[model samples]
Target: MSEKTILVWFRNDLRIHDNEILLEAVRKADKVLPVYCFDPYYFQRTASGISKTGSFRARFLLEAVADLRKNLQGYGAELIIRTGNPAEILPQLAEQYQVNEVYHHREVAYEETEISEQVETALWKLRLNLKHFIGHTLYHKEDLPFPIKDIPDSFAVFKKKVERDSNVRPCVPTPEHIVTPEITDAGELPTLSQLGLDEIVDDPRATNYFQGGETAALVQLHKYFSQDDVAVKSKSSRNSGSNNSSKLSPWLAVGCISPRQVYWEIFKHNQDGNNQNASLLKLELLWRDYFRFMFKKHGQKFIKAKTAEDEAPVLAVNELDFNKWAHGETGVPFIDACMHELNATGYICNQCRQIVATYLVHDLKADWTRGAAYFEEKLIDYSPASNWGNWAFIAGVNDAKESKYAIAAMQPKDMVSDFVTTWQPSPIDEAGDLMHV
Candidate 1:
């Protein structure tokens, strides 16, 4: 007779610590199976033929999965690896392993929701349980002051109410006892080459050093707060491009890190008398939660042109102007600089992100989808909700009914003067190199 087991489906939450789903699986089942699937749908080309996940992010993801597997082994747990549609494969595994229930963290984006529904249908047909936990944000879903439908439209309004009315619950502690289920054979994770991508070395011009997995993320948080004196400069330098931001986005995006983990770390620091910068750090986490809350409410409409109206006007992908801007040859120094950084490194500062996105939509009169798709491909830490939500905001899609932000060349120069100087084109004699006002 096959042994009964609980399959903990590892989606984005990669760490063993503070993992609600994994911990719950341990609590309820004698045998627990850990699994991760490298869904082919992720690497496939889009309608426009561009890869959905570009090389940089692919490299980061590969490292993160490998790290997660290593961490699982330390706890005597084996990570099952597969490459295919989860809806089909998961049910097959459930039947084979006799896994009665599948536990995983909730994913709120368009594709993720659809995929989850398919998995649920498949599991239901087999009479198995699919239990999803919410462990992504600093704020728990059930603890929200309002129902998701009643989530506020304006960020200030939402933050004010949540801050005043809600409390940041302490994170679930990492269980000390871990039980690894017996399994005969587990597959290996895909490598960079197996994914049809080459390994990448960090670019010298890159501002932040980004890594994957939970340990790296926690180490970073510790270093930033304790060793690197990051807390001291929280207000002044967190906005700067070169090594300013927490550089936590990539891990968070892939579930290698949890926002609650970051929040509690900051909270601990504040309790230890590092109170001066605690509020600012907490605010950053709140912003992340805000994006997620918005996504939960708007669904796929967050990426739509008007959020409830017609899709945004589509622009030709091959238009000369579009190609130039996409390739970082816009001939505008500030825009070109920020774009070049994105090309060299898969990241751009939050401030620069807003500016370039606005320029693409409002200034160039390009479709928001074009810019949004490009970001989906390139950004290392790209979250579906945040990218699309911010794009819609800049494109006048969401709650910003009348405030359509069009980027002009002057805006870039004024906002990011030093960034322009840093990535100025070589061979100063060329007329094209000149920064036209």
Candidate 2:
């Protein structure tokens, strides 16, 4: 007879501390085995030529998994790594170990959600209970003031209601240790080449610098708050990515770090009488949670204009202007500079993201989904909700009634004054006709 145990399947919520599944699995099972999968589908090409998970995010994920394994090892737990479908691998392991329950974070993105459902179906066929928990956002799905059917369409309305009436439940406490299961043998993690990609370094000029995983995330919080010079400049200089902001998105995106951890760290600092930048930093986190909750409420629909439920926009990928916009030769200096940065380093400022996205959707008259897909391929911190939801909002397909921006000369002026002049050393002269705004 095989040993009985519970399987804790790791997904975006990677850390051990304050993780709902990690804490609960230890308490309920006689022995617990942790598992993570490098799904082959993640590295495969999309309909387009680009790899679904590009090199930058792939490298970051590799680092995050390494960090997570270390953290789990510290608790006398071992993580099982496999490169295949969870539906197939998980059920096989469950039966092989005589496991009854498989616990994991509840994912909302369309593909992941479908995969989870398939995994559940497979496990049910084996007579196992699949336990899914909400761990990504601060607001638990059950604790929401309204059900998914009732969540408001507008962000402002949702934000006001949650802030006023909804409170983030305290993080579930985590145990320091769990009984190790009889499963002893483990496999090695794949390198970039092993995962069908090549290793790459950070762009020399890019302002952001942070490693993947929980330890790096904690170190960032310490430096962001403790370093006097950097902290003082961050308030005004955050928009300038090359120097003044706390780049925590990569870790948070991969579940190497929890937003709640960042929130509590700053909250504690505020309580200790350091309030100058805490409020602003906290609001940035609120934005992250807001995008996450929006996805939860809308389900797969979050991807289409009305959302993923709606038909995909009619986008012509062969258009010449799109190629120009993508390659940083769009004739708008600021837009070009930002696009250049994103291409070189899988990161871009939030403000520039909105401007470039608007340009691609409205000015260039291209499909918003194309722009969303491109970002999904490139951004290190890309979340399914924020990337698609934002494109939908910008294209005037989702919540908005009218388009708020125009392309003519507004981009040139803003780029020259704000972004281009700052980043590009030898600025080019803008012809009079170029100032069409």
Question: Model 1 shows how many backbone clashes?
Answer: 1
Please report, in order, the local distance difference test score of every candidate based on alpha carbons.
0.73, 0.71
Model 1 gets an lDDT of: 0.73
- Listed per candidate, the RMSD to the true structure in angstroms reads 5.8, 5.8
Residue range 246-302, candidate 2, lDDT tens digits: 566777787776767767776666765445456556666665666666677667555
Worst 10 residues of 2 by lDDT: 428-437
> What residue runs in model 1 are displaced by over 4 Å at the alpha carbon?
1-3, 198-202, 227-243, 271-277, 305-318, 400-410, 415-437
lDDT for 317 (candidate 2): 48
lDDT by residue (tens digit), candidate 1, 159-213: 8888888888877777666666666768877776777665777677654667778
Clashing pairs in 2: 207-242, 301-307, 301-308, 301-309, 303-308, 304-307, 304-308
Q: Pick the candidate with the highest lDDT.
A: 1
What TM-score goes with each of the models? 0.88, 0.86
Pull out the clashing pairs in model 1: 12-255
